[model samples]
Target chain A: MAVDMTQKPILVVKDLNVHYDTGKGPAKAVNDVSFSLRPGERLGLIGESGSGKTTMATALMRLTRAPGRIVSGSVELDGQDLLKLSDKDLREVRLRDIALMPQGAMSSLNPVMRLEEQMIDAIVAHVPNLKRPELDARVQQLLKQVGLEPEVARRYPHELSGGMKQRAAMAIATSLSPKVIVADEPTSALDVVVQRQVMQTLGRLQDGLGAAVVLIGHDMGLIAQFADTVGVMYAGKIVEIGPVRQMIEAPKHPYTKLLVESLPGIEVKQALVGIPGLPPPLVNLPTGCSFNPRCPFAFDRCRSETPQLQEVVPSQFAACHLYPDHKELPPLPARATRELHA
Target chain B: MSKEIVRYIATRFGQLLVVVFVAVSVNFIIPRLLPGDPVQTALARLQTSGGAANVDIQAVSAAYRARYGLDAPVWQQYINYWGDLLTLDLGVSFANFPEKVSTMIGNALPWSVTLLAVATLIAFSVGSLLGARLAWPTAGRGIKSLVPFLMVLTSIPFYLLAIILIYFFAVVLKWFPPAGGVDTTRIMRLDWATTYDILEHAFLPCMAIVLGNVGFWALGMRSQMVNVLGEDYITFAEAKGLHPRRIFVWYGMRNALLAQVTALALSLGSVVSGAVLVEVIFNYPGLGSLLYVAIRGQDYFVIQGVVLMLIVSLAVLLFIVDLLYPLLDPRIRR
Candidate 1:
């Protein structure tokens, strides 16, 4: 399942802003988020809980249901604006163009129904025109693709262990060979061993389908291992974006620097430095920068004026006022370097 | 495979035995503890006018007690009772001239099973389905608005409703018979039309039983459905791009039904016992009516024996249900 990374960009997003009408007022859950994913590109969207990383991924496929509306966003999948499509049109795009491996795979399956019936149900929903024999063959191939025994098709969800259920879930998610796969915390609830297997299977699926992968989680270590492009989100905004190496070695934003420093190192025992202050509640967000209350480098200007995401280096962007002086800021000090190498 | 089946059968039969033993002991012991000789009371009333009157109280009571073996020591009576229960040898009914308690059960058993089982199945299935619908978010505000009214209907008593239905349909409108099973005129020459006629007369009673049980099942199933609707797997099913209907029916209802089926199984026992009021209301010649007559006549053997039989049947049904729990919920198999 070795994919050619040289293929054209398959999914692109520009100035995506999503807001939820919570009756108290409209809270901006995702604001001015933008990124492009090339075919077979493994992009990791890493942030702490409530950072709107998942909201961004869900908005891609128009999976946002009720209250959480896509207020202002342009989600382009191969030049198709998903926002403008009708309900019927969105269904066609969901499984064929983009698929989702949602959070909580263990409890996500039907308990009474056999695993194969669930998979077959997914196939009929998207490709209703496929004959029964073709559908059967496709489902079997998918189970094998995810490294499951074909005999598991007859077993119910409760019969399988947590890891097996997750693998089976992934099998159904990718049954249609969707072009873009958004895996939202797919391995969060699994053990470390099973997590590796699930993630590895996800990587292989991305390669096999040549899909643009959006891996959403709070684990920076996992993103560092698999992602090609890393988007560091803070309080519903993508605060930093760049090639994985540049973001890891030469982080510009204070929050991204803290996130990278917080990763557990292999060598020396460096005290992990976590970002201070909680993310602003979506109901009544901070006036200027949402991260300003937590940003240690918050000057008078930072407190009063929100920072627009601007280019700080070649093909690298950061939403912080500290990068205003230097167009291409150098990497942080090696004490921070010990954060990754320790 | 045979070993598993054998183990299951033995376990079920063992549970049935325990339940039967406990129920019979309670039936026998509770009456004795309630004060006064039941045999003496029966004979005292029989020896004179229906009213409690003074007569040769000692001699008549002694003759009655000795005749029925009630003059034996309490421990010996208890042993005989247990032995008769074990042998399915229910003694003569004190109320009937020569009828055995077991004969009464053999006559009335079919009537009870048919009336109660059919009514309960109808109520549970329809009520659960309706509850599932009410729980659906897409059912809209107008349909959702009816849930409270339906719940109110469920709270009304079945006996009160049965009497009201009898007054209107039987007395006022004269659409059907007021009471009793099938037409007695055609009882000996039973056929399809006679069977259908019996069911027609039994409909109001069945409706009463169903009315009492439907509310609980609907409310329980609806609440469970609401909880299951929000689970991650249901959302995952939607994310897999499955149709809204398939996700609701296959993923939503199927999982929700696993929980509902266990509740339904337990309710079967309750329906059998609870059908007493409905049976009495209709005079359907079931065990309820027979028990009513036996109670009025102070027939100790018949009352105790019938109570024991009902308990044993309920125990057997419950045992089968417990064994079936793993079939509905695969998680329980482990």
Candidate 2:
């Protein structure tokens, strides 16, 4: 899981803030989020639904529509500030530098178009004047890379099976060999076995293209298997980020700990415990820590002051008062001791 | 073509045939059920117009009925009617004696078809383009201003619009002729002068139909375009960095037009019948006016022929639409 730090990052996002004007008020969807992706690095973004994972991804692409706007952010791809690019320039950056493998394979493709047509559209948009035969050859090769037969190019989106569609989508996303690919739950709609196949295809494609990828999903196991590093998001901010092994084995943040503990195990007979309460409404979040209302470790300071994401271990950061930097805060009793006392 | 498409076409064709048959049969039965004998009514009109009190009305009615083959038994007459229909012989008009029903429809069909074709085409193209612009995310003030105007135009009935147009352009300003499809003084020909006169006279009725219909097309296209724009594919297209124009045309309009195609097909099929109100208001020599005259004069044969023609055209139009649908939408191909 070791990544070389000397390599320049392919994509760098800093202080990203996305707000949605829902008429009632502005809801903070993404708040001061910062991340950097090294070349060929796979960064998994894990969060429950409504955690703004998709919104953050969309904002990075500058594809956020009306009622939802990027309030402030700097998305830098290869030293180019994407937020400052013109509409035309942004469009060029989209397919030529950073591509998106959107969620819902069944619906992501234009149903009326043949697979070849859709793929060629993406390819030719950036590299215009590509001759028909050359485009056709490229499409066939891309499809083959995704393990699809060449004849699948003629089939419409509706004709392809769920796995086939996802693969075709992957082909389209990687056809131009962009430096970065942001996939938003690409395998969420597929079955488990198909999910594995898709993930492997994505992994293989990313390796072949050497593209840094932002893999957004809620499945911790999939992220652990696929991503080199994991960023656990909660209510618009990344509460914990570290190497996948460390995040899974010894999560520092209470939310990440709960997420890991929530995964059902087949080897042992353990009762599954759901997160106790719903996420706070973004328009009116609780004061101090956003998670304080639901946090079992909440104390006087935890309820009074918001904690910042600070490094608790080498290369592992968590935003929690339990860390040593917040020495004034009292730590809760250990879980084992509390259970024994109960 | 694939075997599945062939099977789909076959099934649709069979359904169309059944629909046409039912419609034709209903066309025949409905006219027969109307009270009063057509020949008797025709003879009474003739007598009243001539002011001949000494005429034997019953004898004249019997002779006229016998001539028109109405003296036969009901079942026999129905069989003969179907036989004539199958042979493409529409029989004679009772209202206009000795003139065949086919000849009357033949003379009127062109005017109705031409008027509707021109109007609907203009309406569809302009309305759809405007609708698409209005629904576009980047649509500006100019396009937005047309919404209220289009709403008002569409709210007015065809006849009311026609009457207003006639009052302004024909009566008040004398900018165009008030009535008729063409200048009767000039013999019907394909020369420029004749064509100009026809178009000049057609202007108001055409405007009426277009103004009344364009609003619906624009509104329908706008709503459909809005829905299509929200689809996942549109977002995906944007992600691909497609040109705004290409995305609007191929991704947005292509899907939106699917729903509008049915409306277009139905309107095209009914073109032969013409907009009765527009035709009547302008006194244009179209099928609508012919139908009005035929009904008032109690011409059963002409009524049956016109209704049957409309039904057959509608079924054919629907069949064509069904065949072309899979080409536009791949989901239906399966």
Candidate 3:
């Protein structure tokens, strides 16, 4: 798991903010958040629904549409500020420099086109000079690299299985060997066995291209296995982030601790532990730490003050008031723990 | 074409045959269903028009009955009707005897078909493109301004539009002729001069059809394009870094066109019916005008021929649409 310290990060996101303009008010989907990834690094971001995991992934690629605007921040890819790039420049950087493996693999491919044509669409958009035969060969190679047969090149998306379609999309995402791949729940629509295989393919593709990946998903177990570093997102913020082993075993933030324990256990035969309350509404979040109402350890300071992410332990960062005062996250009170409905 | 497509086409062709059979049967039965005898009606009209008030009225009526094969049983006439239809013999027009119904319709068919073909092609293409652009987030102000204008055009009937076009382009402006299909004084020839003259007269009627219909197509296509633009594939296409124009046509319009094609199929009947009014207003040398003249003269045979031709053409159009759908959407190939 040791990455070379001398290797400068391939991607850096600094204080990024994205807001969705609603009739009620601007919903702060992605609050000030920052993370960096070295070449060949994989960062898994896990959160509950509407936790800004997807918004942050899309904003990093500068693909945020109207109603959802990248308020202010810089997504620097190899020291180039992507936000300030012209439309032409941004298009050039996309697919060639960074690619997005979309979440809805079931519907992501254009239904009218053949599998080969969709791949060619991505390849030729970036490398327009390739000859027809060369493009055909390239598509075949990309598809085969993802464990699909060469004959799959002629099939339409509707003709392929869900797993095969997902792998085909993966083939297109990694066609140009981009510097960064933002995979937003690429396996969300697939079953477990297929999910594992797809993730492995994604990892192998990353290894081959030496690209950094920001894997966004809800399955903590899957992310923990595939990603070297894991970050926990809460109400538009990353509450805690550390190496995968420590983030799961010795989380520094109370939210991360509850999240890890909440994972259902098979051997114990105990009722599932549930986080008591729902996520806060984005438009009208509480005054202090967004999780205060749900945080069992909430105190006066935790209520009145919003904590910024700080390194409480080596290489571990957390946004919690208990940090720097208490060396470790305090144990959860037994009385406050509640069992989820079976 | 693949085997699946070929099979699909065969199925659609069968449907077309059924529709044609039903339409032809109805056309035959309609003439027979009239309250009065068609022979008496024709004779009465002829006498009024001074076609022979003195030439032995009873003998003339009996001769007419024998010429029309009305002397035979009803079943025999039905059998002869089918036999004649097989040979493309639609019988002679009562208003212009000895000029066969088939021959008359043949001359007029091209005009109506040409007008419909040219107008629909132009209107569908231009309106679809404009509508697709209007649905795009980056569509300019110039295209947006056409919305109100297109809506108004769609609301106006085609015949009304024909009158207005005649007034402005034919009467006031004198840029083109007001009525008819071509110059009356010139000898019809297959040359540029004749082509230009014919175009000059056909221009107003064509515009009436095109203008009245373009708005329906544009609005239909715009709404479809809007829905398609919101699909995940569109967003994925943008994420793939495709040029906006490429995405607009290949991804956006290409998908939206499936619905537009369906809409076009549903609207063809109305388009043909609407063109009837436009053709009459312009006095154009098309089947519509011929049908109008035949109806006034109670020329049952010509009316039957024209109606049959129109219904058959509509069936063919529907068949083409049915065969085309699976090509655009593979999911329907099954």
Candidate 4:
């Protein structure tokens, strides 16, 4: 689905930095990240494990616990800065204006509560004066909207299949018709067919509610199928971000290139090549660009200085020194650049 | 309510029956195996007191055995034991001659039940609340410091606490009576005055029990609360913007209390046995003191009766707990 670029974004996150005090030292989990989502737009956040995608999602809602904190950031929803709001006001905004569909459907819903009870809790937390019948009707409607039968609401989370649990989570998240929903790996625990069903349900829910979505996952293929725009992360930084089609077809960042190349294709017979090195430690990141240690295209400039995310194409942005506009620096080697673009 | 639940209850009841039978049989056999004879002991006590020394010892001994039915064969005694049990005849207490075993227990049972039940309920309620508070991430250091202190208190045996309390409150302060369930010298009426005196006398032993047990409940509940707090659903609850108080009670304590309920049920089931050490220390006329007396005097009938009562009561309590389990935890229903 297409979203109008002229519309004011429903959620704007600017320079979010989250750090964890791990006793040994501070580990930067999310470093200087910024993105925006227009209403009904699906932004996929794809990264390797521990690359801060989940951390970023938690920080957006101010859900980071002690020992880990949002060091600095501005998460503005509908022009109101969430970070500046008191906990009381933030809770008012949480489900009524923004909601989260968390990871691990099996553990995300209370095992002791019925699905309807959980949904009603979310509803009544925001709309306190609603009567029981009205609340029950709302829960049933949400369950139906998520492709679940009304009777499914009566069962506890354990009784539901993995797919049903994910769908129930989606139902609760969208129950209030919040303007933005952050879904972190909603389909990670399901089989392929159920994954497709959950994704489609998520798509339908987002479209129906006209809520912007930030879908976080490690599965590139799943992200590609659903994300209107894709952001590739390495270590704790977004290395490249662009329109999904453009980024997949022509990835500019070295990390994004490796990610795109690593997608296994059933139609095309090609041995999948993995990225060469582990993501740099968050505590003691490599000297220059976070991705430089593993980048085959890294040069002396890549090791000495960090590259800012600059527009490489009309709409795509990348953080690699090999991109044009680094004055007096030699261009990337022809053989390496050729091999990447091939 | 359902066929499956009914089946589960029936199975549990059957198991309870087996346990009760085994316990009753053991109660009958163990006292018989003891080396000393109760009738002989009684006669010796009379002789030591300079009374009945001139009487014919053999003739009296034969008459006593016949009167008490100890002259029957062992197998017949066993059969008669079951027969008397079915008819609710616990024979007569050898220590308190001519007094039925049932009457002695009947008099003592209420005091123990009242003391332990009130103390346990109070301890569980207060401890669980404090434990839930301590488990909160933002709980202050002052409250968190109670964990180790409470742990030390739990490690101290109930009897030790009883001694300490007795020394300070009874011996030193002289604020309350030193021992006994109630003052028999006072008018034994169901007046507020009598009730107040009974409670006043019960204060130290009850406090000792409460202080010793509250720590365990707090520790159990705090660990469970900590575990529940770490669960993903708690995070979800927070993300849902539920009130913090609601989150603490519904999301945190509700789930944490599941394991604790089973613990509470098991502890309560053993309440009939009474806190044996504390009772012995306080000289409280509860089952624990009764058991101690019966053992020392080799009062076989009294011992058998009390043990049987404890086993039957515990089995009944457990049966009720089993019925209530699925109600408390829905997962167990299946």
Candidate 5:
């Protein structure tokens, strides 16, 4: 894929692959995934469940446990290779360079402890040099930044509504002002209204920090709303990636085309062609393209020949046989076309 | 705040009173309902010894019935029993030998409470910490490998572990004495030296109880921690670039530990009231062992009174624990 010629990337992941060694065999959840984020840029990773979206997010944090290992990869944040860093060095990088906003983590806050205590504990952990009064002021400021009532800091997690909890989570996520923040499905579980509010909060926080964000979600509409770039994943590989507008307008990969069409808000009049069949089991995936079985364009060559992501246009990239010849393909099927009202 | 606490305490205490009354009455009535008079059994032993024994069985039975008010109608007996209980006059023990029922309890109470309370606290606190440590995925492979084995060990009964400890520490190694509290000779003087001696003697038994429960507590806490660690707040703390230890210890541990504390408190109360096997194995003069022997000897009044005391104590313990819930969990408070 053609790289942006001008920008210096703040975060770069190359050949990132994660696999779980289950009792049966190894399941390749993420395979040869590569992406880069420039300073202050927002990249959205969109995929269905088991599409390696979560795996990629956690692999960034080294959060996956033993059976699930990052087989081969280099996660470079601000030019430092995170994969090669020592545990202590990684800890430093995690706190000061890159942070993660974990999904559905708000309910886990200590009910017996006040929010101020929990938030202060976070500050103390990474930035121990702060004075007590400064710490208290920072916590109060954080609560305010997250749009919470100032007194919310003194309340327990359970006392807050779900949206408030997500805000609190975002506040903490941005607390250290790390260069890159990886948020995995931050708004997936929230109500529609709360979801919009939380997303806006995240946007505002990201804007304030000017930190690169890797927003992981399956919702294309959500990605369209916030993400500057969209990376469409299928069976553990980036099937398509480009500017969000370009990808939504002229998705080159069949997988991306289907995802954009499946979005509920998109003004498609015909019956939405739901992606037939579930995502392939990471273990014992089909030969050649993992999406081949469900790919309408699949043929003899598509079955046996593996497709690598290659440049399709000036900046767009896709992994598909139809785009193999580097020629502009026909418009997507009627059902895959974008609706004006979307 | 104080009003909520008072209401919480009052409701709990009132519930405890009802439970205690029910338990004590059940202890009194169930035995009476059984065929064959307890007094007859006592007299039967005397009769076997021949007329030279000179024990009047009928008079003895009448006195026994009168003492417990069993000579009255059953309903009247119950009402009178409650009347005596309200006045804190639980009647004289039919088998106290020389002391009053209340006096025996006074002497034994301290020993039981000290042993059980210390042992439970040690087991719960240490076990919970260890469990939390092992729950961390990054802690290492060695500890992770032990989780399954610990879970298997958790299934073993507490008494089985106690017996194993007794066999190794008491009978085999002989590092600690097999049973009883302190040297009987040293128990009379409650001096520092003797107190230390008493604690030393109780150590093996206390440790035995702790070992029996530590695995279970660890397993329980580990599971709770595993779930809590996945909570969004913990993730938020981590995202905030919170130190791993702070996220885990303060946020993760504190939240997950509420369940552990509740379980521990309930277990401790039950353990205090029902230390039967441990007391029997160690020959500690706890309430369980005392009541066990009293029933076997058919010491009717002593057994009844001790059972009532145990029931009441257990009820009170539960009440206190219930009251502590709102204090521990702010969400439970208004």
Candidate 6:
């Protein structure tokens, strides 16, 4: 969907903090994080496997479970603070204002119920007075919209392929045409072929509904392909976020730069390169920057003081001290970047 | 039902027939295959026990052999046995001569079936519900307290539990009969009073079975439910804005029950064996008690008849489960 940048953000997240209180201490799964999504915008949040992208997505829907509490954050959807809504109102708001297309497509639908029954359940819970014929029609329309055969609604989940299952989930999430959809790694459990199909279906559905989406995944290439705005998350924080083009061609934050460069160019025949050092433990992050221990350009100041997201270029923000000294990120020294095979 | 389900049922019914045939054949062949002739053994035992030294042994043995058709050729006898089984003519009880074994079984079958089946159904329902609630996040402390109590219940044998129940309710409280199916003094009648008396007499034995088996079903269901609650669909169901109750029942308990049903089918054999001990302890007039009394009294013909009934009933129970499983899970319908 072509994002209307001038439109006011349909969903706003402010100072969101979700932590899992372990015996050692709280694992800050989602630290103080904030972002906004314009109407019909597609924002992709990318990170390492445990970079809290999922935590952020789930928090937006206020579906965070026990031990992992949303300590203090306001998820405002269409001016309604979802965090503060009563349980009933919060429940009503979900799937109507904002919905989650869960990560595990293989298990998203109830195994015991038919696809039609599962879809009808979600619709009936929100719009209780709808007649059975109307519900059936809605289910058929939804199935057809997802490019599924009408016969699919009568079949169980086990009967469907992986791509079909993901499409079915998409159909459910957009059943009410919710203004915001939080898709947490929607294609994680699929093969590349099925993954592309599911992603394309999701994009088409988002465009059809004209609803903003927060697409969370670890794959930089996949997310960049679909997102208008790209956010790189590290240690539960959004380290950088900007237009996808700038974020890919000229990444500002050292971590994002290292991440972008790590992707082997299709034209090159060189071995794969990777960022050195693992992601810092969430509970005990580095003294200043969460990425300082892993950054190739970490200076004395990087170890002493944490940097907030600052505008390095027009519409492009990066959380780093390097932005102050240079107009653009300098090339990484040869020894700084780790090459896997060499 | 669709043709797939019909085919599934037909397949299951065929398996039931095979199992019944094997059991009936085994019951028929094992006795005849014994090293010594069963008629000769019965005659020898009767002579020794009855002190009938003056009676002619040959005449008595021949009469007994002719009475049960043991004097016929082996193949003819096997055919007659099959014919007799078809007609429910299980011959006459040795201990209670002139009373047909089928008549005795028919009299006792209803009591046993009602007592055991109803108690088991109640236990399965109550236990499964309790287990689901226990695993549920919002279930109160009241239900949580049941875990340890259930563990304790599971460990104690049912017969011992029956004795303890009889002691408390019948001996201490004088509220129930400690033994027997009904009061021998009361003439049996078709009325509310008779029904109430039967139910009252059934209470301790029923409680013994229910209390004994409930813990197993509850524990089995709890683990299944825990795993089910962790499934992705449960979270999706919650995200669908569906009420927690709806999620708990349809999304949680319904899926968990597939495993519980399989467990119920596998445990039916043990349930029958366990019933034997409970029936003997309560002196309840059922197939189990009949088997026990016949064994103790050396009533060979009555014992054989009761055993065949038990085997057939068990096969029928398994067939019912086989039919039920596909209804619970469509994946099995194929």
Candidate number with greatest DockQ: 2
lDDT of 5 by residue, A1-342 (tens): 233448799999999989999998989998999988998888999998889998899898776656789999899988989889886677677746787777775564666788888777767777779998999899989888889988898888788888887887777777788888899998887888989988888888888888889999988888899988899988899998888999988888888877766666545556444777778889988999999887766778778988988889867899888875647656555543334442
**Residues forming the 10-long window of minimal summed lDDT in candidate 3 chain A:** A1-10
Per-residue lDDT tens digits of candidate 1, residues A165-225?
A: 9999899889888888989888999988889988999887878777878999998888888
Work out the TM-score per prediction. 0.88, 0.93, 0.96, 0.93, 0.88, 0.96
Q: Can you list the residue pairs that collide in candidate 2?
A: none
- Tens-place lDDT per residue, model 3, A28-133, is 9999999999998999999999999999988988988888999998999999999999999999999899999999888888999998988999889988899999
Docking level for model 3: medium
lDDT of each: 0.80, 0.85, 0.89, 0.85, 0.78, 0.89
Q: Estimate the Cα RMSD of every predicted model relative to the unseen true structure.
A: 4.0, 3.2, 2.1, 3.4, 4.0, 2.0
The segments of candidate 6 whose C-alpha lies over 4 angstroms from its true place after superposition are B50-60, B71-73
Per-residue accuracy of model 6 over A65-178 as CA lDDT, tens digit each: 777889998889989899999999988998988988999989989988899999999999999999999999999999989899999999889889888999999999999999
Give a tens-digit lDDT track for model 5, residues B1-334: 5797777777778888789877977976887788876667655754564531454556656766776665678888788877877776655444444356667766677787788879888988888888898887676888777777777666766567678887998789998887888777764685899877788778877887777677888888899999887665665555455567776787778777789878966676556643667877788887766777766655666677777777777777677678767877787775
**TM-score, cand. 2:** 0.93
Give the chain B TM-score for each candidate: 0.86, 0.88, 0.93, 0.88, 0.87, 0.95
Count of residue pairs whose backbone atoms collide, per candidate: 3, 0, 0, 0, 6, 0
**Lowest lDDT block of 10, candidate 4 chain B:** B268-277
Point out where model 2 deviates above 4 Å. Answer: A326-342, B34-38, B45-68, B265-274
Q: Lowest summed lDDT over 10 consecutive residues: which window, candidate 1 chain B? A: B48-57
Summed over model 1, clashes come to 3
Give the per-residue lDDT of model 2 (tens digit) for A1-342.
245789999899999999999977989989889999999899999999999999998998999988899999799999998999999999999968999898977888888889999999999999999999999999999999999999999988878999999999899889889999999999999999999999999998888888899999999999999999999999998899988898988888888887887787889965555677789898887888888887878778888888888888888889898887543223323441121111
Please report the TM-score between candidate 6 and the true structure. Answer: 0.96
